[model samples]
Target: MKHYVLVHGGCHGAWCWYKVKPILEHSGHRVTVLDLTASGVNVSRVEDIQTLEDYAKPLLEVLESFGSDDKVILVAHSLGGIPAALAADMFPSKISVAVFVTSFMPDTTNPPSYVFEKLIGSITEEERMDLELGSYGTSEHPLMTAFLGPNYLKNMYLLSPIEDYELAKMLMRVAPAITSNLTGTKSLTEQGYGSISRVYIVCGEDKGISVDFQRWMIENSPVKEVMEINDADHMPMFSKPHELCDRLLKIADKYA
Candidate 1:
């Protein structure tokens, strides 16, 4: 069976993949869900995390632990794309394919934060009001993190049912410093990160990321293939778990 490492987005944990994990495993593929530092059940405190490298250590460590010739299909959702890309760069040979699901697919020229800033500029005034960068630190320890505004969870994240939105609010945490880290410079070469195959999954009804921004990222940093799930929101694993699983399995069958 092929191995798949599923990475969750900002403020989310491995728990987000509960729906997709079993479906993939039932189909005879190995699946591992990850919670980055300070996310999900991880004990790492947000105050303790300063750099992107520290935040991504969990994912990097998992990839490094794998023996040579042990390859995986790296699936990243939303902000998880940043670290997944870094992992692919660190172990190009170990990653059979990197699937970016409604996530930022950055390159040396266009990093994650660059794409984020551009998206910020393209949104409407009302959308701008809904995007808040909450401060979670004291004067001595400054922290800038983004969280969706009121009513945004249902509109941007859930798009499935009201109950799912309630669950998301209970589960969601403050995002790590990774988003800010993307604004800074990162070392990613064409041979290192670009060598591995990549796929992009677009969520047609995504309001958090938006289809236009997703398309912009795809155009900026091209991928080998692209897949779209209509009426799917930012959290497709919750909104369209079966369809997401099917598409993922198809990707694994074709590339892994």
Candidate 2:
């Protein structure tokens, strides 16, 4: 049995993986779904997460608890990719493979914030819709935060089930928009984060991330392999749970 660590995106928590977790566990794999800082049931406030490391503390601690001989398949969704990359960098040997599911996949060459900046740049003002972006900290060291709006959530879950969408509306939290730590000059090293095998899953119908942007990221930071869930939306765990699980299982069979 392989171990799978599922990481959720901005404004979401472990609860978002409700559909996918049971399926993976039923298939005899150990699935650990995480709620990043300030997300899900984690009590930390968004204001407390001043840096990328702060936001990723829970995930880092979880990875640290693994025995030296153990390795996991790290699966990151959407904004969770940045913290997942940080974990891979800090514990390369602990991760057999890092699967980016319609998530931002950073390159070793640029700072971790590059992909996020690209996304912001690509989005038009109208496209931003009701999604709320706020700032914290002083003007000299400002930090960003985002809260997904109801209408925006609708777009994100356009193809997902109504029940799952309701669950998200009930559980979503405010998330840091990258944070100052990611804006720093540090980049992932080839000997660290780059050492792990990486795979990218494209959600073709996702309006939240957009297929065009997802493909662009794939080209910008090439991965070991590329897979597609053509009918999936941004929330594939809800929109295409079984298909996502099948792809994950196939990846585990080959890579883990």
Candidate 3:
């Protein structure tokens, strides 16, 4: 069986993969769903998690746990893309393939927020003020609802076929502002991009991040394959598990 490491986005933890994990396991794949240091159930203390480095710890530990010959696949969503790209560079040989689920695939020349602003149109200072008046729950802050955006509320629940909005809502912890604001040590560009294979999965109807943005990420990364789900929105795993699985299995069959 192939091993897969699934990472959730900001303010989310391992819980994000609840539906897909069981299905992947049922299909004979070994899965490890992780909560990043400041996220989900792993926080030593939410505010105590002070930097981007803290966010990378859980993923780094997971990779370190694997043996030299262990075959691992990385599946990252949204902000989790930061760590995925880093880990693949840190331990290239063990990572069979990397997948970005409607996520960023950043390089040193580009900043994460810069790309987001560029793709969806930059958020004006006044807009930031409006978004900060959010209704969503965060572990440390109550203003995360702003990130959800007008479109996030509409399409997030519809992206996947599964009903996971309640769980996602409950797990809405405040994300550390520094992950993107501060800057990462390096990007996929600064590191070796050719060491492992890369794939990009586009959530066609995504509202938080658009279809055009997804294409931009793939066109920019050192990607080898592109998978699409037109009917699904940002939360494809929740709305269209079968389609996501078909594409994943294809990747496995092709590489494993």
Q: Name the top TM-score candidate.
A: 2
Give the C-alpha lDDT of model 1.
0.81
Q: What is every candidate's alpha-carbon RMSD to the true fold?
A: 2.3, 1.0, 4.6
Write the residue-wise lDDT of candidate 2 on 13-114 in tens digits. 998888899999999999998899999999999889877888889999999999999999999999999999999999999999999999988889988888
Q: Considering TM-score, where higher is better, how would the candidates rank from best to worst?
A: 2, 1, 3
> How far in Å is the alpha carbon of 127 misplaced in model 2?
0.4
Q: What is the TM-score of each candidate against the true structure?
A: 0.91, 0.98, 0.83
Please, what is the whole-model Cα lDDT of each candidate in the order they appear? 0.81, 0.91, 0.69
Per-residue lDDT, model 3, residue 65, is 92
Q: What is candidate 1's lDDT per residue for 103-185, written digit by digit as tens?
A: 97777665545665566567787766655666655665555676655576667665676666777788877775344453356
Which 10 residues in a row give candidate 1 its minimum summed lDDT? 177-186
Best by lDDT: 2
Give Cα distance to truth, residue 190, candidate 3, Å. Answer: 5.6
Over 4 Å off, model 3: 111-151, 159-163, 178-181, 189-194
In angstroms, how far off is 43's CA in candidate 2? 0.4
